[model samples]
Target: MKSINGKVIWITGASSGIGEALAYELDKKNCKLILSSRKEELLQQVKNNCSHPKNVRILPLDVTNFEAMPQKGREAISFFGHVDVLINNAGISQRSLIMETDFEVYQKLMDVDYLGTVAVTKAILPHFVERKSGHIATVSSLMGMFSSPYRSGYCGAKHALHGFFDSLRMEHEKDGIAVTMVLPGFIATDVAKNALKGDGSAQNKDDDATKNGMPVSELAQKLIKAIEKKKMESYIGRKEILAIYIKRFFPKLLHKIILKSQVR
Candidate 1:
């Protein structure tokens, strides 16, 4: 694996779930980190748990605050002089049917899960270009590869990331910018518990699939490997990942199976 020691990496949504796990995983490599989230106190808690707490700077950020990203990005750059890697792991999930879901919920999903990431990346792109080196990693989901029950908006947002980042990779080769689209199947995270319901309220419960999926630490390690390899894209998790291939090679079969599954 490529050594990330002493590299400066910035992670959004650093308070919990995959983001928190990534911080811990990278800390072992002696990386300098900037942890960001809307909750400053929680971010501090994560920083405290890192291998070198003194080296981990906590930056409270809300990716959904599109207008604030330029300033936040500048602050991030100033904190560490420069960022070697930017991990976009901040996103919201949905657990609502398309027809019944509120239009506002869809807007929020696009705003937070899709455009929010675009905003942050655009804010930092100039720095990466000037340095002629950087890695951009986004935490996408299996839902991004194909549609699933009660996740229409969430899937839409993730699918958009695939398009945007793939195009970014196509255009930024000379700039030495690498983009890794990390598509995880399901890791034991609070995503489902905090997922948006049809009315735009938190889902407030866990899904069986997520509860039974790969551990977050395991997912974080796999993600680090992919990022170090500068992989264009990668998938993580157990059986859920196989569904991506099935959907690709046998659309009808995958559709039938999805319809019969207990996703909701």
Candidate 2:
């Protein structure tokens, strides 16, 4: 089994869902964790639950605050002396059609889900490059690889991450920086309820499919293993992962079916 003992990992969006669960799982392996999110209270709560409570520290931050990330990352590095891994998992979901989405809404999604991740990654890249070792793990939706209705902004943001990070992996391979792109199907997170609608309001409710999706704990476990093993890419979830295969081998048929499917 892959292990993360003695490694220092920085995880964003650690206040809830997959991020919070990952803190618990990784803590058990005695990995020093720097947990970040907008909610300081929630981050503290998560830190308290870690198996190695003393090894976990909270660094509340808003991912979109690009100007502040460099200083924040320096603070994070000071917490553990060095960071071996960075998980860019903080993101918001969009729940509106392309035509219905406002320009600001789309921009916000990109700001948080794409540019936000990019900003943080860049802030920490020098550290990894100097040391010649680091890992980057991010959460991307399956829709990122295959577009679906009612999630145009979200898909755009997620798809952008694939393009940016995939290129970064190639360029940084010589620096010993590993990038793992995690594609999750339907995860049992509050993302649906928290998703933004066309008018910039919360969807304020969960979808049936999301309610019955994979548990947060399970996804966290799988992600930790992926990072430890330095896997290039991996997908999590139930039946949704199969869509990647269908789109690859049966593109025309998949498109026809998706056009009529009930995604929203």
Candidate 3:
């Protein structure tokens, strides 16, 4: 197993939720952290909460600003001279039916969830290639592997990540680069509250499924374990994770079950 202790890790979306939890967890493991998000103030808060605050650096980044990612990547690498791992956790969710959703909402979802990740990965890829070592771990939802009502855009964006990252792994395996796709079923966080509506507005309210999802701390532990083991794909969640297998062998039944669940 790969050891992350003493490794410099960069995490986008570090202002809250899974990213914030990861900062605390990794700090406990003696990992150097570079935390990024559009919310610099919140990133500072997360940094201060860490046990080894001195080892954490806050780098504010807006993932949707595609053109700025290369510079951001350079800055991230400069934090401790090199980044050993990049956790692509910056993403937004959708909470509207496809018909009701505006075109811009879909565009925003693609920009933030799919292309933004591609941009950042491309930014740091050269460094990884040159050093012949690196790990790319992304937080993709279970929705990426199957269909769900009101999450059409989210599913599409996440699915695209799998395709792109899978190809990256294949093309760069000889370079000693590692790729891990983290498929989370659900975790108690503000994802639903921050999800976009049909008109590209934040939902601003929590849903039942999300409110009762796995705790963020538990997910963080599992995520670290997946990274340490260098897993190509790790599904973390409750019963919702079964959807991946069901979608593979019993697609029709999975569809019926999803519909019956009525999880918004």
Candidate 4:
């Protein structure tokens, strides 16, 4: 098992949602954390709420800016001496139809969700390689495995993550680096309200699925457990987890049910 206790972890999207929840959970376990987000003030607030505020350092960063990742990664290493885990959790969701979605919306999705993550991983690769120890964990979605309506762009990005990280895990395992992919079902967060529409505008409203999703804090706890176990891939959430199996074994049936779902 790969224990995170006392490990230096750098988490993107740490200002809100799952990242924020993960911070609070990991803080209780005595893990040193570096929280990154576009908002410095919000990151500071999350740090304050953690068990050991002093142990949490805020590194404000926008993942979409690939060019800045190297400097940011250096800043993180300088702050903690070394980072044991890099959690690529900073991403956006989409609630737009494929045809109606603007080209720029898809571009933005790929930019932030796929390219941004890969950039940060490349930036931190040197640190982990030199140390011969590190973990790369990503927060993908169940949509990465199974498709649904109004999430074409989001699903595409998540699927890209699966491909990219799976290859990363394969190539880097020999380097003593590990990778874990997390697929989560709906957890109560503002992702829906903040989701982009076909016009590249915010949906600005939560859907029924998101409104009734599980609490984020619980998801964070389970995520940490999976990381501790060093599971190559893990799923967290409600009955939606069954979809992965269903999609693989009963594709037609899964398609029928997903069509009936109000995921949008």
Candidate 5:
């Protein structure tokens, strides 16, 4: 297994939820952290909360600003002169029906959730290639593997990540680059409240399923384990994770079950 202790790791979306939880967990592991997000103030707050606050640095970033990512990547690497792992955790969710959602909503989802990730990865690809070592771990939802109502745009964006990252792994395997796709079923976080609505507005509300999902701390532990093991794909969650297998062998039944769950 790969050891992350003492490695310089950069995490996007470090201001809240899963990202924030990871900062604390990784801090405990003695990992050097560079936290990035649009909210610089919140990133600082997360830094202060860490057990090893001195080991953490804050790098504010707007992942949607595609043109700026290359610079950001350079700045991230400069923090410790080299970065060992990058966690692509910056993303927004959706809570709208396809029929009612504006086209711009889909665009925003693609920009932030799909293309944004690609941009960041591309920004650091050259460095990884030159060094012949790196790890790219992304936080993709279970929606990436299967569909769900009211999450059409989200599912689409996440599904695209799998296609792109899988290709990245295949093309860079000889270069000693590692890719791990983290497919989370659900975790207690603000993802639902921050999800976009049909009109491109924040939902500003939490859902039952999300409120009762696995704790963020638990997910962080599992995420670190997956990274250490260099898993190509890691499914983490409660019973919701079964959907992946069910969709594979019992497609129709999975569809019926999802419809009956009324998750939205």
Candidate 6:
């Protein structure tokens, strides 16, 4: 649409990082918000910081709970009649070499990043289809576009999202639905620290590059502009964002750079 003003938006993973920044940014635009995350307290904190506090509501949820998604969808719709936009920003990251990674660790990444997103999308699709109008924007990663070391599972999950959402866009184009896949490079978030390790434990610390990446608010602002314009996709970051372009025209050069880069 033209702007987020007065439109009802549902954002998952609103407790922090990009999701929280989005809530604040859109709130300033007068958008009504339904924020969800596993941490209700943190979600509330985010809601409190919104420009229009009255326009924000907190709904805690775990995206992996597929069975409960229908009820969650109903609750979300009841809160705002019908959601005009759904931001699927909830996901976890993985940081482990495949050979050293545990199978369960890899599975958890798929469960949280891929299947969880699918579950939320499936839950909301019926409403969008019935109404024949809605926007689905998701936060995938730069790794989704290009592979990286020690992130096999994370890359695989993000790659799966690209495949699934690309197909969804084609299938639902006639239904007046739109899908925007956002590919974010390293932002100043604690995702690296909280990412899953090979033993199913938290990495509990940020990587060097991620720690010094672009500011979250800046990325959030740009992403909001892209959403307002209904752009099909937008890539964000400073240096890392270039990887997506380089991977396209100079695949060999990109591989050589990645091989020598200290991602971990």
Where is the poorest 10-residue window by lDDT in model 6? Answer: 44-53
TM agreement with the true structure for every prediction: 0.98, 0.97, 0.99, 0.98, 0.99, 0.97
Over 96-136, each residue of candidate 2 has an lDDT whose tens digit, in order, gives: 88888899999999999999999989989999999999999
Model 4 misplaced regions, further than 4 Å = none
Pull out the clashing pairs in model 6: 193-205
**For residues 1-264, what per-residue lDDT tens digits would candidate 6 score against the true structure?**
787778999999999988999898888888999999999999988987877888888888999898999999999999878999999999888888888899998888898899999999888899999999999999999999889889999999999999999999999999989899999988999899889888999999888888899999999898887888888999989978889889999999999998998678
Instruction: Tell me how candidate 3 scores on lDDT.
Output: 0.94
Over the stretch 1-264, how does candidate 1's per-residue lDDT look in tens digits? Answer: 277778999999899999999999999999999998898998988998887997899888888888899999999999879999999998999998888899999999999899999998998999999999999999999888998889999999999999999999989988999999999987899999999999999989998888988999999999999998989889998888999899989999999998998576
Each prediction's whole-model lDDT (CA): 0.91, 0.90, 0.94, 0.91, 0.95, 0.90
Candidate 4 C-alpha error for residue 154, in Å: 0.5
188-207, model 3: which lDDT tens digit per residue?
Answer: 99999999999999999999
Question: Which model is ahead, 2 or 5, in terms of lDDT?
Answer: 5
Task: List, residue by residue over 52-83, the lDDT tens digit for candidate 5.
Answer: 99999899999899999999999998988998
**CA lDDT, candidate 1, residue 216:** 98
What lDDT score is found at residue 77 in candidate 2? 91
Which scores higher on lDDT, 2 or 4?
4
TM-score of 5: 0.99
| Residue 256 CA displacement from its true place in model 4, Å | 0.7
- When summed lDDT is taken over every stretch of 10 residues in candidate 1, the lowest stretch is 1-10
**TM-score quality measure for candidate 2:** 0.97
